[model samples]
Target: MKQLMDLANRDPLARRWAKNCAFDLMFGVGDDHYQVEVRGGQIEAMRERPSKLTSWDFAIAGPQSSWQAHWAPVPAPTFHDIIAMRTAGHITIEGELTGFFANILYVKRMLELPRIEGWLQ
Candidate 1:
């Protein structure tokens, strides 16, 4: 996850999307959640949780299969994008939406880090 942030930080688009982005966000797959805190355009911390997600800027939650597909080395069509997954009834979004919508590309890029880094499972 740190590597994901590091990669995103290097991208001009990502940096632009992250400008003034200071908030806590999280995503869930099945029973697990990863809460991430961002400050000054960089990741402050990320912690694993079991539904103890308190305040957050946004959240992306989906089934394990959906997450697996999203992280796949070569994802299938619908799983390749967050909105597509949501459209297909595979994922859900919650919390503040302005930031989420504004930095959507960057957020999607972050979620695709595992694939870009060849950390596919």
Candidate 2:
């Protein structure tokens, strides 16, 4: 997913959406996890976390199957968006909500990069 985040850096909309926003987000795909640092609309880093205690502002976690479905070209209903996935129990979001909510749009757009890139297809 680091590649997906990297794609966001070149995306005009993603860059604009993230302008002036800085946050650290942890994305979990089953047992694997990644920490993505965004500063002033650029993704500074996205690396796998070796320990669970690694610091991050917020986290969005779900099983691999859930993520795969959500990344599908035409995602299944409820899997198309984060809130829908969370409400349907397909994913869980935790940690500091203030940062998450404040940059929710950016986060959402970041997550959709794979789909937008047609990488999954």
Leading candidate by lDDT: 2
- 1-121 per-residue lDDT for model 2 (tens digits): 7688779898888887898989998899999899988898898989886467779999999999998898899999999999999999999999999999999888999888887788789
Score candidate 2 by lDDT. 0.89
lDDT of each: 0.79, 0.89
Q: Look at candidate 2 and give me any clashing residue pairs.
A: none
Model 1 clash tally, residue pairs? 0
TM-score of each: 0.83, 0.94
The numbered model that scores best in TM-score is: 2
